[model samples]
Target: MRNTLLVLLFMAVNTISYSQNQFTGIVKDAENGEPVFSANVYFPTLEKGDITGEDGRFEIGNLPAGNYKLVISSIGYTSYTTEINIPAEEFEILLTPSAIEMEEVIVSTPFHQLQSENVMKVERESISELNKNGAVTLSDGITQIAGVESVTTGTGIGKPVIRGLSSNRVLVYTQGIRLENQQYGEEHGLGISSMGIGSVEVIKGPASLLYGSDAIGGVLYLNPELYASSGETNGELRTDYFTNTRGYQSSLMAKTSGEKLKFLARGSIAAHSDYKTGNYERVTNTRFSEKDLKAGIGFQDQKYKADLRYNFNRSEIGIPEEIGIQSTRKLPLLPNQVIDNHVLSLDNKFYFKNSSLDFRVGYQFNDRKEFEEHHEHEEDHEEGEEHEEEHETHEEDEDHEHEHEEHEGPALEMHLETLNYNLKYNLPKIGNFEIITGVQGMYQTNDNFGEEILIPNAETFDFGIYTTAHYHISNWDFQGGLRFDHRDLQTEQTLSEGQLIEGIDRSFNSVNGAFGVKYKFGEKFTGRLNLASGFRAPNLSELTSYGTHHGANRFEIGNPDLDNEQNFQVDLALEYRNQHFEVFANAFRNSISNYIFINPTGEEIDGEAVFEYDQQNAMLYGGEAGIHIHPHPLDWLHLESSFQTVTGELENGGYLPLIPANSLTNTFRVELENIGRNLVSSYSFIRLRSVFDQNNPGSFETETPGYSLLSAGIGTGVKLDEFMLDLRLSGNNLLNESYISHLSRLKPDGIQNIGRNIMLSATISL
Candidate 1:
């Protein structure tokens, strides 16, 4: 690993070249004069590049002293290309918006724009951000956003969690289309990758107002390559090699566009051997490898644009089980898992004189195969490796592995399909008003069950219609939405002590909505209020699942008679921003009626440990506050800080699992540019983060402790006439502080986190 880092660092310093003549200008909205940020300014053949800033200013620093064709493009805008000469001084250029006689453009302010009351945008480094495991995942990108967390099984598998919900509570939309798969498994991380993403936006609260169910926790939007104003093309090639895990990851993406059409394609592959925790102990018992592929085609003249996309992924992992004692230590034996998933989607958009429309339809299929056998497994408790001593002693005293039965795997198959339609109209005749409406339908079929306990093949169908309207009167923007859903669920579960008995039937219908208002306080601050309602039907797997999940080492059970859960939420946010500073504070409280819950009773039914699912009245509530500072004070330094806390409990005072409590993150950034005139250099940032102990009450499982983790990184980029390069070296847990995260099942009794590690990554544009 150390040698790999040295090599990457050497490459960073070796890739320097002479300069080229430069052309520079600022691009803004023709109507509003708002700067178009991060607009791609490119010369494709030369592989040269520049990006517009927050002020919409772009400058190609080194132009190889010549007349060159330049292309520029931005989303929701027209493309422009022309020939220009790079003299000594920067020149100002203006471009016009694409004209197709379409509706009033609703400009998406970078990342959540922070421009409008109805929409919130967050812009930051997603593709460039690395994870604790040293390799980046889309899931890692979401950690920076408030009200977001990951249900991680290991460094390789982290599922997004919104609000106080995970699993089906949150929805993922990539390129304006929904993604569905059987993600309940531990290794489902293989299902998606962040290869070519430009940015990620998270809607932190109830969003049934627009996206329908599953938005209960919120929504994650992963957008593709942002187009430049010119008619050229865009692309990137990034390769990351990690030392601690002894693996490599590579990604490549490309896109091309003309006046009427745009197309994009990307592929990625990551492979790693087992990684070690602190010391020389290998925490991961599996050797894992994953591959991802995605392609998209889009068509547009002026009034309409349609997109078709397909994604495929596959992974294989060794599921190691301890079967015997090797001198008082449990010995790991060969056991394995194989998983594969495929998704295909189509989305269409149309723009008229005063309205914009989007339609989405998709299907996803998955097949998982698993194998496991005799092993005595116990949780390590949400604490570090303090339990290793006990594990070693027990192995020496008892015959733990040879007595258990060999666990056989199952044949798993699932298919889910969704069809959706949405339209937003900016009613010019109705003054300042925008109305958004949509309807979505989904049908899913699955054959997932155990031989002893059969949950017959089942199918579910759901349809929903929703509408949202934004009305602005003076400084106040009032927004509200209403949604209605009809659901039909058929569960096939045979009840038989001997002969087969027919399965039962069930169904449900629900209504959800939200009302919100934002009051602008001058140009620097805004206060917003939202009152929302959300509902979730019991998922097929949640209702009919029955089996053993060896990853967590626990027998599982499910109930088919569970009812739907409904919730009411109230949230308030205050935001202030200006040229060099930004501050945001948010608060919310949610009350759930008929909350569905799973309980483990330390009791076993027959030979399998029986866990039951039931409904109860519960209350979930929490809030977060953030403050950022990027003052012009030094021109060479920047700092930012944020804090968040949350808590929840059952009606009977039982504590909810996995509630994040009081956390803090602080970051400092400094840079130096225009070095020796030919070079622009910068040192990005250093961050400190920590999480407090979880003491929210009822948890028979275990508890999590407060621990502090330190991380630091530095990077530099070089620009040549036709080539550019970037490099970064990062380290985490420098103190080797031992701690356990709440979501880690192994932290309760298995292996702890990897102690200390460093990584270096590089990107090259050809």
Candidate 2:
């Protein structure tokens, strides 16, 4: 009789476990009792999801038995979120209609939370939304967000500047890993493609508590395109054309997903000729081209999920000089760069009864080459003529000939390889408190293989450990984290211009922390206050460089005794939102110790101005404010306005260099849904931007005049039987404004920014 009881108990346990693996839910409109079809029901932590069918029913199976956060979202409705336990009764979700934009998940933070619930005020924008604003490139698109700007060399090269800091201060992440492409140089571009990117999240302040070194200023996190819904297959083809540069862009993407397996692939190519300025003069050697490919595969079961992704990109960018040539050539001329990059990453997650573990590993390889025009000197020819008689009788001349052949090739070539990993454990939630602990590290190497070496060959190793927690009580949320990091850098001595440059080995350590609080006032107001500290170790160029940077037209000298840069920043944000109106303001103050910068030494080397790296204490303060309005009855109309300002100064006396001028933007937009039988949606918009004069210039910089620009765009989506077509027409600098941006690298040469450019784009979905 005892044996019989044991068998019955085991059978009951198995039945319970099987029942807990599946869940069902139904979605309906809150106002009416009608089903809401195509609503997305997802469990983010579990990596499990399903879409509601026509009858508003969704069922997800093969889930581990645990308490999970359930989210139900649909267009034109407010998203619903709640905590659910396995084996619970069926859920009936009611969604309320809303005119405001839907909230998105913030992935850059340790805890993935909705934007409305996050302690930090992160800015997020979709790639499609940026493209609709007539952005010519990814770096250009980010400038549309307040408190963000770009240092542009020309139409082909740009670097992102957050607040008033740039270069190695800001960190960029893609494919779940930090991007390393020798970002210390001002002439280097972002080295990222816009195709296959879903959205971008910007952390406006110090994020070293989450991402260790090099995040003293901020971070830019890019999210890849998601897989298709389960049991669905989709494909798309897109094309774009620009008039100012005679540019062409084309891309293709396909994705398929099953219950346990998913796959996606995308390929894109872009080419452009020299861009014309407002005066109809084309800048010489400003053309550029790019090719990119992205692929990903994922698998998930009851307790584990794994995803693997790969990206390959190649770019050919021209180094713009004086306005000399007028040809509309697609290929870049001499004094250009060729860069190839490859990235691979693997992400894995394991689920337990009440907790989870995540492991991610990424590898990246970058190959860069620069080609410059080779000039022959008359003295060298005369010497060669004298040696011609001896060359015919000596075998050493053959070696000299081979050396000459090599010198005709690329002037600079460098290879960089990086490997990084992250392991995080999410502790089981205790009531309304959650915690996570993680370890992150990276190993990288840089090698030079050309005639010119901008930086000596070096290797670097990094390790960091951190823990973060979040607590919720009443209408308040609190978050804080602490991190410790260590780095070891080693370099090989080399010769530059017959000088023996000494090599060095060094190690650095740092400890950083962050704390933030969010409070809700009534139902329409929210406030956030955050304090964070960050640090950055000096990079290779700052420590070892001793060469002329042809791209920047300057000779650089490095300082090997530079110390680590540390900073502290305090940020405050206030937001008020309702059904028809929204307003937000963000303010921040940052103070830094050992702030590094470049200054002219009043010397010349190889016909280039000499500059040396130095450090001092600095301070920067900025604020951004924006407002959105949509009248009660005129919900289709939107009026938006925003203003951004920042100022930087050295503690000793002078203003900081490269600070963007204050700017204001105003936009008017109209949107319509389902205008006709074949028309799915349509939108039209016009925007005006004004930049205030920058009278307070750095000691070594010149002042810039103020300017204004106008832009307009129109777009529509059409349904044709089994396919959907999207079309857009946009124009930038519509009034042909002749002005130079304060951050333009070519401003000293009296070069005007691109103007009067029109773009047409089309996409077909199947």
Candidate 3:
């Protein structure tokens, strides 16, 4: 039955009628009035796109008679999008130089358009800007975005929290594929590194209509670096240093592009010692080191395009323990972890006479292992005497003794493999509407080879189908979509010493949808309203786990009869902008049915508290507001401030766990000129951030006090004839204020946050 339906869908997508309305355009640079060659020109409604030739001209011959959304973009330039009528005369499009916050190209949505043209708003940040914040990890840098926070175990490991949701509820995409790295655990951090990435795109609300399951909270999209300009080759070397942890990082990248082919490569390495707290004391076993490499090759022509890429990451991270003595060690002691991740993907785009299609496939492998120290009882022995020699070597002598005596191997090891596939088609223009239909899925398996087991071996399969559309009118944009998904999971019955542990087979299905509209009130104001539904299937750890959680120091038991979680949310946003000032606000409310969470039972298992996974009805609501001002007399002086807050509560009265505290931040910046020879565009800024006390406590949760931090930074760029150099110096937590974050996993132990530290970074490009 499924095969028959798929065949019909393919047949409908391939059937198209050609048209005769031709549209021609020329692209040029706005600053210098020069032709911009190799620029991209596209029409989303017509499903037609092409790249400019040497003369910066492109012609699409088969566009139907209708209103279309046309976009033109090039490297190092802001994207331009406008509504146009078919059968029109030739037009000219001008591209401006990229600014600090340029108009971004929206991904994760079916249609590609500029942020202003998109019906649903998205948050974007450049990699260069994130680096300037003195962030040591990708997860840490993203916290700078309003309404976003990070749950940290230490300086080296953390996870992203969107509003009041995190862990498996949040989804991450890299290399155009979902990342799977056993993320349900409190100690598991995001596996991908920030090196070689171009930018980050975030959808702060549910996006299940496009991304399917596990997108109940939000989506974090990482875009890879763009290919070099036609017939261009470039290379860069970057390095950074951190004073608090005595850490260093370095990376190198090279890329080249030709008329029909392109290639790129990047490699990076980072190492850090144990971090120091605000009290001037070192936290034991908090050090970590990482190595990452990425490479890609691509080929494109008039009708076809294909790209292949690969990424590899390895990390050696230490697990903190209160029993260990304080010391500034560069390597972990006894209990530590070694993890490696590899990903390979292939993306292909095919263009027909009046339509286009895209197909992507990816494979990922993750290997994780944990090592623990083995204790031995004291025994009296003669000096230099050997009393451990066996008289006769038996078949199981060494193996039996090692298991019962002193063992020297990994305490737990797990290997995970996943394969993903996606197929999407854009239908030809029909009136003033553009429609997209697609299918996406994944097949995965997990296996363990260790004495201690956390989750049983399991196999998971998922499938989803969706259809989305966009309509553009005079001053209004409309978007809506519907999606259906199903997930099937099976686990082998666990057995230990002739005792049964857990086994399960279950299937979950859901139907979700979204509708949104954006209206331009005038040239200086805009408004948007969106309503969406999302769902999430239970993860392996939440359904079959049965072990001791070393990081939380507790016993965890999973419920096999758990059901899927469903959510519905409404988002409203408003913005007002002009030459001197800009302000924006976003408000949202989300209600969930059958929300899954772990709760303490007031019971003990083997001298540790027992926590069980359970379901409950919950609600969350929040809002974020910000403003930016640049004085008229002092154009170079800039001021910005923002506030974010969220409240989560169960249906009855109790609050939810792991909710972030409200925060407010203010910044003052000024531009400088004539600093030195060959130097231009020098700038500096001072920032203050205050976190409010978390008084709304959940069951078994405690209240946390508030704290304030002050920071500052300065940076500049220098031009050499054939080489360019960039330098920055930043001071974080300059006040060295002692504080504990409510979302920190180590808060129970009274571990203070990082101390005052200095950071330096430099980049040389050729």
Give each model a TM-score.
Answer: 0.78, 0.93, 0.88
- Superposition error at 383 for model 1 (Å): 20
- Per-model lDDT: 0.61, 0.88, 0.82
> Which has the better TM-score: candidate 1, or candidate 3?
3
Cα lDDT tens digits for candidate 2, 1-766: 8368446744643454333377887899999978988888888788678989999999998888778888788876777788899867788999987777767667898777778889999999999999998788899899998898999988878888899999899999998899988888788887888989999999999999889999999998999988998889999999999999989989999999998999999999999887888887777668899999999999987777889999999999988877754656666766788899999999978777778888889999999889876663112222211322332323234324434644588889999999998888899999999999999989999999988998889999999999999999988999999999999999999897666789989999999999999999987899999999999999999888788889888988999999999999999999999989999999999999999988999999889999999999999998899999988888889999999999999999999999999999999999887689899999999999999999878877899999999999999999999899999999999999989999999988888899889999999998
Best by TM-score: 2
The better candidate by TM-score, 1 or 2, is: 2
lDDT of 3 by residue, 459-478 (tens): 99999999999998888999
Q: Model 1 misses residue 671 by how many Å?
A: 4.8
Number of the predicted model whose lDDT against the real structure is largest? 2
lDDT for each residue of candidate 1 in 1-766, tens digit (9 for 90 to 100): 8368446644643463334445678888776788887676765323345678889998654344444446666643555555564454664545555311112111222111123334332223345544422434566557766677776654556677766677777777765656666555434553677776665666777777666666776777776655432366767688877655666778887878665566878899987655555554555343466788888876653344567877777765545332122121222223444567777777655433334445566777765554444353544431323444544555333323422322344333333444433333322214566566667767776664433442347677778887767677878877787889877877664553353434546777788878877888997788888888888777765676565545545555666678777888888888887656678888888887877667776787446555666778887777778777755656556677888777778898777776665789887877655455335465767778878887773454566678777878787777766666777777766676666677654555555555666777777664
Better by lDDT, candidate 3 or 2? 2
Q: In model 1, which range of ten residues has the least summed lDDT?
A: 104-113
Q: How far out, in Å, is residue 608 in model 2?
A: 1.4
Candidate 1 stretches with Cα past 4 Å from truth are 1-125, 129-135, 184-187, 227-230, 318-336, 374-429, 448-456, 495-502, 606-608, 671-681
Q: Tally clashing residue pairs in candidate 1.
A: 32
**lDDT score for candidate 1 against the true structure:** 0.61
Ranking of candidates on TM-score, top first? 2, 3, 1
